[model samples]
Target: MRTLALPAPRRSRGRSAVFLAAAALLAGLAVAPAAHAGDGRKAEAATLHDLAEDHGRYFGSATDNPELTDTPYTELLGEEFGTITPGNSMKWDATEPQRGVFDFTKGDEVVDFARAHRQRVRGHTLLWHSQLPGWLTSGTWSADELRAILKNHVQTVVKHYKGKVFAWDVANEIMNEDGTYRENLFYKTLGPGYIADALRWAHQADPKAKLYLNDYNVEWIGPKSDAYYELIKQLKADGVPVHGFGLQGHLALQYGFPGNLQENLQRFADLRVDTALTEVDIRMVLPSDEAKLAEQADWYARVTEACLAVKRCVGITVWDYTDRYSWIPAFFEGEGAALPWDENLKAKPAYFAIRDALGVRPKKT
Candidate 1:
């Protein structure tokens, strides 16, 4: 899960501190020509999906069940994107509220929308420490008991959406920032082997679906990312079913862009697996100024370029399309506007910058 706002700038003390200070240099990269503003007027244009498709990639966004009823909001999602990941619907809490029972109502809604729009679907997560049902979280179980439950959960969820989803984040945010596994329910009960077990179970249920281990803060080469690299490398050696590594590219302008982001993604690519910017949003401390917005746009363009540059980087997905429902403000005080579109669904500079980065030719009006 994404952490709170970045720590305030501090005097360089070590490698991490020095890397954090490099945000300024990252922001100084040459900016792309900005595209026209998204004025909410429907016009003939090269949509992000079309441009990305030309480059063998799919552009996507995450949407929640509540946003489905908003006609304009859904319209934008259906038109401008090629893939949809239900932000919370497919999580354990929403799927299996009780021990044995399962619910597909919320997740089905998103899948239906994607089908209607001819967009692909990505299963958000099967195992995550957060947003779990009370039943699973409150009760304690032995290692064997917990392992059985986890297997059942993974198998059942993967089987239910077998043919529908193209990729599944089998595990989410299992690693901490310091390159260690977080002591979550599964880790505490079953230990680190749980990751491999989760991936194996998911593959057993749906061999066709691409299984992935997804996390945030590993967009660059750091302790956190290094841990993932080692883990993924080991998994590959063991012939595990780990198919992809997801970088939940939740970025903030205050914290400089990740160092060697392209190189970091390339390293994962060397493992012969796919990579994606699973949940991308560049935020700044609120009351956004022109400079901050411009910087945000630059970051967006750079992220798109980074993915495009890497052959194994499949695509990029924003946390959501518009800032009306961004999770940043709710979690981080005085921080919002983390999306390419504004609360009013108007395309900000970042939107056009993305089009430029994707090499979309301007459509004649």
Candidate 2:
């Protein structure tokens, strides 16, 4: 699971969003003259989630089932964020291990944890190309057969957690980096209509859950983001229930910052749908040094600032919030240290940067 989103700008944002930001700015200037540099003691007791809520947003992190048993890790996760996304529990393979029969055991653990912590849950995904159950992936099917299977999977999963989950990544990473459809199982079998149908089916299951199209590397305005912009506009025109767009802010230091980030988010806000950074983590080439860490911190702050600047951009969720269980080192060898917390759970420069970006300044002792 991951968080994806874009950068700043209200750009004809809703009246309420504009008013809140303006009011917060005015109040910040009155209380702490150095507002950009530091926030006032009003937020001294605030966790990352608290600071986000101050601006009518949420701060969240992704967690997997195994880590839930680590009391220390779970403690911090429960305390720090207002929302959570299960890294793998809610995925296709985990939920429906066998055909028709479903298993909600792993996903339920996360939902229960979130309930106990008073946190909102964002369903990682209802559909994706990867991680399908062996039966579904191995079996052959015609368009009609596959469509029914897909509808069942999406509806059953969405209906099961109806009120518990606030949003659903109805379809994940359906686009290629170059802006073409991924031609995945759904795409090849059912054609491009699969996306619209998936969203529709998910909505039917849980009409209230925000349906989203989630993808990585769409943080900036380019071919990929452009495709989503146009597609979303079309969906809205066609009376689709698509509610949000998720920019999986999986960034690397080597790649320069997305110059048009804020502008990109602004454009989407202009479309009147919500936006979010779903699986945020800025990784660097490893054997990390102070310079690299500082750079990563800056990137985190930039991303936070970007989200804050946009009105419909609702929230941000770091992939796991810590490097100890980071998916980077294993997935991308020779690369690691992607999270704000160290292996031992120590706050790194990136952590302070995010807190500061969220407008919190610890009370000087």
Candidate 3:
């Protein structure tokens, strides 16, 4: 996280005919004011998803099973996003609480919602260090025993959701901040080879679905990202089926923005794997002021622009759309207001900034 001044907003109204057609779909919805809200600037009619689709990218948000019951929440989720991730439903504890019994009731709810809205789905995680079921974490197993268990879990989940989920975070947050592998249960029992094994099992279950290795704090070309660079390179060399890299862009104002984000993504693109901003949000110290909010907007714009600049960078997804459902304050003590929309579901400056980043150009008169 390094500090840098945000660039001024650029203005140009010329746009493609296709954009104008798509913007018409935004009519009647509560989209924020145009990039230039007042000042006689023409209004923007397209949703963030609509504008993003124009560039062959998707704008998405993560939704939990509980939030699906909220009508207002679901309405904005459907209208604004082109893709969705199940925040916790697809995790091990939720999907497979019992040793061999699998329950997909919650994950299915998210997939069903995504399908109804015509939005693609990103399967949040197949393996991770957190939120694991008590049975799996508490039990002791030999190398062979754990390997079998891991494979079975992956294949069952992938096959059950086959052809529904477009991408799966086959592995998540498996690296340490200093570029070493994290000693999670899988690693402790199965050692480093487990990474390749997990990716392979997931691929076997569904060859069509893209497999991604996701982590946080690796948004720049640092030791952590460097570890992934080498790991991915080795995976490819060994003919593993890894297809993408997910940089969970969880930023904090106190930490500053990631350094050389575009450059970092480009290096991964060189490995022929797709990249995405998996869980993006810029949180600030509590009691948010105008200056802090403005800085947050600039960070949002920068993240979007970084993704757009890279050819292989597929899309961007906020942790959730509004601060109403944000997981920040709950975990980080006093740090909240991390999303583009406020708790009331009203658009913040970050919303307009994201629209601008997505090429929401007004028509040239």
Assess each prediction's global lDDT (C-alpha) against the native.
0.85, 0.84, 0.85
User: Which pairs clash inside model 3?
Assistant: none
> Could you say which candidate leads in TM-score?
1
Q: Which of the two, 1 or 3, has more lDDT? A: 1
lDDT for position 223 in model 1: 81
> Candidate 2 residues 48-135, lDDT tens each?
8888988889999999999998987887898888999999998999999999999999999999999998999999888999899899
Q: Which window of ten consecutive residues has the lowest lDDT sum in model 2?
A: 29-38
- The residue ranges of model 3 lying beyond 4 angstroms of the native Cα positions read 1-43, 360-365
Candidate 3 lDDT by residue in tens digits, 222-256: 78899999999999999999999999888888876
RMSD (Å) of each candidate, 1 decimal: 6.7, 8.1, 7.1
User: How do all models score by TM-score?
Assistant: 0.89, 0.88, 0.88
Candidate 3 global CA lDDT score? 0.85
* Candidate 3 lDDT for residue 105: 98
